[model samples]
Target chain A: MTKKTKWFANGYLTLVFVLLYVPIFYLIMYSFSTGKTMSHYQGFTWAHYVALFQDARMIQIALDTLLLALLSALIATAIGSLGALGIYATKKRQTRNALLSLNNILMVSPDVIIGASFLIFFTFLGIGLGFGSVLMSHIAFEIPIVVLMVLPRLQEMSTTMIDAAEDLGASSWQVLSRVILPAIIPGILAGYFMAFTYSLDDFAVTFFVTGNGFETLSIEIYARARQGIDLEVNALSGILFVFALLLVVGYYLLTQYTAKRQKAGVKRP
Target chain B: MKRKQVLFEMPYFFWLAFFVIAPILLIAYQSFFNIRGQFTLGNYATYFTSATYLRMTLNSVWYAFLITLFTLLISYPTAYFLHYTKHKQLWLLLIILPTWINLLLKAYAFIGIFSQDGSVNQFLTFIGIGPQQILFTDASFLFVATYIQIPFMILPIFNAIEDLQPSYINASRDLGANNWQTFTRIIFPMTMSGVKAGVQAVFIPSLSLFMLTRLIGGNRVITLGTAIEEHFLVTMNWGMGSTIGVVLIIAMFIIMSLTGEHKKKGRKHND
Candidate 1:
């Protein structure tokens, strides 16, 4: 607000940012170092990065992680969006509220609880633990988030549009594909991305549900980290860091573009 | 349309009933039974009667509370500061960006920071102080926990403060309110919802922090989360693990109730 206060704020903000970024900077620096220990900086080398990419196990795990995220996110988004639509379509307020509260169980429950329950349930079902269990677990937790994301968007949409589409003799399927889907596409996309990221970042849930030679990146990182970390892990993390940054930037740009288009459309109309 | 809606919801409803509801029900079921399939309250009895288990739960709540408290204290001012800054969006983005990075990576990075002969101790040594042990201590654990939580706490508070109309502050000023008075009477009360939301976000996750308890705390700090992990993974005791899981669910609900999130929703409906 004032000059002195402005300077003070800048100083405080800088310190906070430094605290946030310095550890990450340290990790990135060590990833390139030829040394194994995190403490020292040795001759610069790309050996860690090379090893990270070249390792068959790491490559497989990375692919598995991506595949799991994609599949789980897709399944969750589909079911969740439909669930949102159905919940919205319900005429009775009581049923809608009941369904929402049911959804909140998955949303609020700790991952450990979810993970443990899933683990026991799968064990009980004699499914054991592997890709299927992990994927199911991801979808189970992810659905609620997707529903929450899409529900608000659906609620904001004017019901008159749907009514008009039906009145115009459009089939239910046609109205869904052409009208409802198009109107809530952004929410669906948002839900998908959120679900995907949650799947990718998840550890505890995956940890509990994964066994019998299955591994995701987080699980692998946890295992390796417990044995004391190697620089290859740092290399993997650096690459993932860059990937996440790019994703965030892309999302930001996409939102900005949509906002601009919306504003332009409003002005034109 | 209603029939079509039901058709669409059928698969999801089955999934929720089986995967979402059934698993929690399974936990509740397992918690009541022992390994021999005999119905018993042994799990709950063990949790409530054992001093060690009770202490672990207390530690979980205590550490989680401190983490939330420290995060709020740090983030509130930061959010308030960012609310006035010109590049508020950019600053907010910067704050939130790290959360995109995996929690494990961030925790791993802090390992380097608090390690012996690491940057922190190295800096202390540079300042003519002895190299201090920062790793595996309560302080390091709390520090890392708070670090991970800051962004989550900041965003909500920032949004809440930003949402406040400047006219309200001006009106308070016009009525002869000083900055402190205005902040106390208007700003703090209005932004409390955000604070509660932030606390909920940070506090809930901090409760079940398993990996960090091992990596950062070095097995020194044992929480209910780590205990659950131990019961399920190490001991192969599903009943005990399920019991702990059930307790955590109840605790989660209690926290939700304390935050008054459901009550707020009801108030909004009434409005």
Candidate 2:
């Protein structure tokens, strides 16, 4: 809190931030380098970016990865929100605790265990390891997080509103759609965003479930990285970094807006 | 309303059974069979009896401990200091943003930075140490793993620090405790839960960072994850993979119990 301590604190934080961001910027910086390797400082060129744009397989895989993230996050959000509601509605504390523990299994298990077990499960069920398996695995892993995110919001909601809706002759469906859904929308949105990021960033689970022909961006990056540095992959990373920045900024703005609106609502009352 | 709620919850229950419970059960069952599809306990037998498997498990646990320890060391102070900074939320967001970038990319970045002529080596050479092998070493692997896990450790600790009541600190000061004494006696104990949570988050994943073992460790550092990947994907030995998978699960449960939250029944006064 003193001047010297404040300076020390600022310096330490600056060091940590530098350590965190250097790798990312280093990766992106090389994408524009004409050199094939990251060792030397070659002059800047747009060749890697141009190459990235032209790589049909990479572009296809990128689009597929995006599609997979969107679809899995959507499905997971729906199922997980319902699961939270169900758990909330349960009358028995033992059943509720049981449900909560069951929900956390996926969240706690290491990726290798989840991936290996899911692979065995799919093989036993005769489901091919490809897009379907990958999507299913993503959704499976994502559901728990969605439930975690939404359950707190559900707990925070007052029961009086639902009772009033029921007393005013609103049907169950109408009460859910008109009252509960609107109230819990922020949590649902947060869950969806978290799920989307998880799906997008997942490598280990996707690596196990993906068959020979299918690949996500993470898998692709892993493969190319093992083969040593590929500037094209670097180019793709640069673009993805920017895309991720945009997504984070957008999410931050959304959360800020909702928070402000909630404050205003409270003030008005 | 109850019927409708059940109708909506059907998919969730189905997911719980099929994906969550069933996969675990299936993996445990699959551990009994060999690659030939014959029923046997040979997989577990091999894992238990083989010296290689035992050593690998030990090494895996050792590396994970180191990673967790180093991550905790760096993150605790970072989180503690970060709590006192202005615009702390924004700073926290900056810490989290790096995590959103694909982890593989971050690892790949290290592959470049630690390479023969990479930045670190370049720096070393400039200082006349003249470019030694920086990549594919245990130190490099540990460094990168800790770097990746730092944010995770910081977040929970930061939250815990935020939750600490200011009155307690003031009370401790009023009772004539110095800063170090106050921190050691009060601040650290209260934030123990966050440290436990951070350890759980970092340690489990560190055990299975197979890709990091490959990409950065140059396949020199083999963890349980690397072994699982090799068995399931490379060797096509599903039985062995499942066996290792089961061991990993048990290890996870052991850790969970060790760090498991004990209900704060009543506040204890140290005075």
Candidate 3:
């Protein structure tokens, strides 16, 4: 490429990054503003943060959101990992392919359709929408993701290890718990984290299933935002944004550490 | 052991049958009926017959198309540059990091930036330009949607570009291929999978943007999602809502089939 083309590419990329991040930085800055509007940046104040903590309902909703995400991720991980293992072990290609395709239905379907269907289904069952339905909906969407994650790891593993374990008279349970589990733990963890974030960021699906007296943080934010913009949300958003960034950074650091250890001729646990 | 393995899968199968298969079937089934449990083709007919619904469908398609186009336009070069950079991982992380934040929060941030007295106007004013109304316009709606979707579009394309073997590029150069030729013949085709995925990721969500349209578009941007929300929430017409839901589902399938990978049948048979 010519020098002008190179300069143009660099400039274009820089501009894209600036556009991507400016609003985020703006939001973070305004979170500390004493004024209520976004136009003027007034003297810095901790009032929004103070109010965010003081709002018991918002705090409760945040906790509820985290708890729901954790529970759904945990359940989805267990079932999905087992499902992947079973599918991997299946002798018939058709059965395995069929199962995989069935799993993709949830993955491929639009979120709104999933949300709407869940809404109609829950109402039809006469189960009043609340935390329970929300959790179920989350798990339903998350399982396919977990399965896809773990399945790849399983496929990458060497079947010879299992055969060798069996030759040594190891039980199936022993082989699974000892060899296979340790090998695919990273994939499982990755799947869990991915599922957790999906649950955290989910609004469209949660919007339909979430009902009277139950609200996730996203739902609450949506409600407040639709009514009018609230500065308190900016404070909470600052915290959430930092929390997500830290999670990604921590995950990256963990992987780097493990990779370094492997490079140093240390065995992966 | 195989029997036990099959047994282990039973719960998942049941879950899929109930949650995944049953719910969608219920929506399809409900689409043909009115609120009073009377069987009718009225809901689908109403959707097909009404100008409002037709317009909404077109709007959804248009928005999805535009957002996808813009996202790819911005993301492709960014991904290509990042692929060649030494700090690829760090830059990629920065790109992916914001996506972890909630979509509502991002939309809220855009609201702050796009508001009448917001930073965009404030900055323009400082530059001697009049403070133009940015929020609630078609421009702001597309801008916010494109902003939210950019990261998603970038990651897939970045992965595809990163996975492209350097040897192919080198070979193209060795074969006297020009820069443009290498890009068009080698890099672009190799990155088609990523393009497909990125398009799917960005386009699908753009079609059904509910909160962004309401908060950012100020309800002026009436897409299919807005229509569905109205039918369910405001109109109390579950049948019509389900009808739209069914249509949306069909549209998704059509998009998938259009972009889906084809199997090489003769090669597989030979193998």
lDDT by residue (tens digit), candidate 3, A1-269: 57888788778878988988888888888899999976688999999999999999999999999999999999998888888887888779888888888898888777778888898899889988899999999998999899988888888788998999999999988999988987778778878988898899899899888888789999999998877668999999899988988899888987787557545634543
lDDT rank order: 2, 1, 3
Q: Taking the candidates in order, what DockQ does each have?
A: 0.74, 0.88, 0.74
Winning model by DockQ: 2
Name model 2 segments beyond 4 Å from true: B263-271
TM-score of 2: 0.98
C-alpha RMSD over true interface residues, each candidate: 1.3, 0.7, 1.3
lDDT of 2 by residue, B7-31 (tens): 9999999999999999999999988
Candidates 1 and 2, the one with greater lDDT: 2
- Model 1: colliding residue pairs: none
Model 2 alpha-carbon miss at residue A213, Å: 2.1
lDDT of 3 at B81: 88
Off by over 4 Å in 3: A1-5, A257-269, B262-271
TM-score of each: 0.97, 0.98, 0.96
How high is the TM-score of chain A in model 3? 0.94
Error of 3 at B17 (Å): 0.9
lDDT of 1 by residue, B1-271 (tens): 6677688899789877998889989999999987677899999998899999889999999999999999999999899998888988888888988888889988898888788988888889999997998889988899999999999999989988988988999999999998899999999988888898898898988899989999999999987889989889988888888898888888898998898674578688997
Docking class of 3: medium
Q: What share of the true interface contacts does each candidate keep?
A: 0.68, 0.87, 0.72
